[model samples]
Target: MDTHDLRLLANRIRRRDLQAVYEAGAGHIGGEMSVTDLLTALYFHTMKVDPAAPLDPNRDRLILSKGHTALALYVVLSEKGFLPKEEIATFLQHNSRLNGHPNRVKVPGVETNTGPLGHGLPVGVGMAKAAKLDGADWRTFVITGDGEMQEGSNWEAIMAAAHFGLDNLTLIIDHNRLQQGARLEDTNNLAPLPPKLAAFGWTVLEIDGHDMDQITAALSADNIASGKPTCIVAHTNKGHGISFMSDNVAWHHKVPNEAQYKQAMQELENAQ
Candidate 1:
């Protein structure tokens, strides 16, 4: 898909995500909305994986480290035909495989079970190292929330990635600025993330997270350095497409009431 189609697909995923959250009565909707574009660009535009053969050893791997926003990935996976689309409606329901966070065992496309904040990047490092050991060309991609970056585990993995020269690894930080209860700046500001990662010997690329063209280009294989991992600081807005919710801290985990849901859905509809 070109940039135009990718945007359209992203909007559709947002609509589906909003509906799922509203129906489920709970989700990390703010983060989900913020990360939709990144997830879309990866599954649709960048990664090489066949839905029918999701576990193919040669296929690229993706880890949504900011696992609270698993609904967004679940929607994208459904759109990618990794699972039945209707199963999304069962999100957060009793015994639904589509839990709040991804389950690698239950979900076809999910590479790992992620929900704890700081686990994804380190695990991603392991996957990338395995590929290196096997002399495989496949890449590993990990997306983590900005707030989640405060975890010491991520920084440890960052150093390890650079130490091992894992060039095939790309860590995308969803720099949305908001966390569960307040702004990340107010809570534990890790602003200026790029320089810190660069200081650790990783090549860092910064871009507007919502822009599909920038996203796809940044994720391109050409951008990876020969002996250093890549880190993309994707500046994004929480609740990105909805007027009332965009960048609002309150929406971090709040469900939209009927009126809010309608308005949000309308905005997403017009967004396409």
Candidate 2:
């Protein structure tokens, strides 16, 4: 898709995500807004998979390692035709398939169950390695929170992905600089993230996480430098697009009050 179309789709997804989060009475709306553009750029512009044939062996894969942001993924999947957009209203409801974290077994497009930090990259590495072992041309992409990087498991996965030469893997860090409790810098800082990934034998690309064109280009197959895994550090704003909440630590998981909800919904609609 062209940049204009991508932007429009992203805005629409953001609006839907906002509505879903509001109506469901709970969701990680802040992170969902932050990652909407990146997810839109991937599912609509970069990834190769038929919504009707979600499990097609040759299809490219996406793992939202920041699984609390599953609502964002669900909105994208709905837009991509994997599920009814209306289903999003059931988010976090008891027994609802649209849980706070994505479950691959229960959801069509989700590749794995993810919510805990530091788990996505390892699973993505396994998927990429499996593709290489099978001589398949498919690629695997994963997006994780910046704070999630503090998990030792991600480093372990990073070492394995590099050592195994799983060049088909692309890891995107949602470097929004804020975690639920505080700013990344105030918490366990993972700042100098690019240099760290580069030192691990990965090709590093930095881009505005909210820019569709840049996100598409960075995720394109040609962007992967051979013999190395690819890491795209996506600089983003937590609670992006919502005026009162953008980058506000309180919004991390804070439920929006009635007035705040209305304002947030209006802000999202205005973005369209």
Q: What TM value does model 2 have? A: 0.98
Which is the leading candidate under lDDT? 1
lDDT against the true structure, per candidate, is 0.96, 0.90
Q: State the lDDT at 147 in candidate 1.
A: 94
RMSD (Å) of each candidate, 1 decimal: 0.6, 1.0
Query: Across residues 69-123, which tens digit of lDDT does each residue of candidate 1 receive?
Result: 9999999999999989999999999999989889999999999999988999999
Model 2 residue runs over 4 Å out of place are none
Task: Extract clashing residue pairs from model 1.
Answer: none
Candidate 2 accuracy as lDDT: 0.90
Q: Give the alpha carbon lDDT tens digit for every residue of 144-217 in model 2.
A: 99989999999999999999988899999998999988899998988989999999999999999998878988
